[model samples]
Target: MPDTTLSNCVRDAATQAAGLPRRRSVPVSLIAAVAALGGLLFGYDTGIISAALLFIGDTFALDDTVKQIVTAAIVAGALVGCLAAGP
Candidate 1:
């Protein structure tokens, strides 16, 4: 339960709703364009990672510990990205 109520969201007189965000949505074309770009980037990244990991694993002859290190590094990078974008 929230102890403090959020009041930053204000409804205009035109709408009867209060204490809630107004219903809003981005345009479908804009949303679809962003989604398409994100999907493309995701596919490209996964493909690159698959190829890179083969060389990376062989170069390190990675033990479980080293594999963990690589995984942790990627996780840390994602966390930093989230922190940068968060409110």
Candidate 2:
């Protein structure tokens, strides 16, 4: 016969040791909201730049090289910022 009492005792001990209650110290919804806000801002900035580039090019009479440089500058800045922030 299986030892049900031993199995239940082991399971209970494991659950207590895992400290599941501490996990909710910070609300999941708040964490998700902050993450969502960051993503929304990133998307907004990208879209604004994409749309503005057309008008900026037209206004400045930019050549292909200059347009490429402008786009590359934004990407490079983002790369540098990411690197500085660290993993």
Candidate 3:
């Protein structure tokens, strides 16, 4: 077998020769801003759904149970997506 030390030295030298830059960290303020915007959009979405429920109910003849389900569905889907995408 080849010497481990020599192999590691060559591998490291090859890596350095590739000249790839290290990954940079994101700024806290930018992260916070994006989170805030997401929250705002979510709030607006629920608010619009609530506001339109009356018209939707009239059009679709949805009962109380179904309306409750419709309202909860968005939240449930968001929960599932977040869990699936989590580390």
Candidate 4:
């Protein structure tokens, strides 16, 4: 069997010699705040259209078919955008 304790000691010594910081410099709170802001913006962007569509439909005097088409167009645009940003 391999000498696990010896291997661990060597690994720790190598890491210490490399002069890398063992602790994180950036705060976790800052990372969480940024992530939360992104989520809020994404939620607002996807949800605002539904609320605005009511006023838009009334102002334009749009029928159900046209209103559906407008909503579908927004969804299709989002789908295309997501596809374009694929991993």
The per-model lDDT (C-alpha) reads 0.68, 0.80, 0.85, 0.81
Per-residue lDDT of model 4, residues 1-87, tens digit only: 755798677876777999864454477878888889978976787688888888999999998899889888987987898799897
Q: Candidate 1's residue-wise lDDT over 1-87, tens digit each?
A: 533434422334335554545566679778898989977975686567667777888897877677667766765876798699897
Pick by lDDT: 1 or 4, better one = 4
- By lDDT, the candidates rank as 3, 4, 2, 1
TM-score of each: 0.47, 0.54, 0.62, 0.47
Cα-lDDT of candidate 1: 0.68
The per-residue C-alpha lDDT of model 4 at residue 80 equals: 94
lDDT of 3 by residue, 1-87 (tens): 955798677776776789854333579778988999989988998899898899989999999999999999988988898899897
Best by lDDT: 3
Give the total clashing residue pairs for model 3.
0
Q: After superposing candidate 4, which stretches have Cα over 4 Å from the reference?
A: 1-43
Question: In angstroms, how far off is 70's CA in candidate 1?
Answer: 2.2
Which stretches in model 1 have alpha-carbon errors above 4 Å?
1-27, 68-72
Prediction 1 TM-score vs. true? 0.47
Model 2 quality (TM-score):
0.54
Give me the overall lDDT of model 2.
0.80
How many pairs of residues collide in each model?
Answer: 0, 0, 0, 0
Worst 10 residues of 2 by lDDT: 19-28
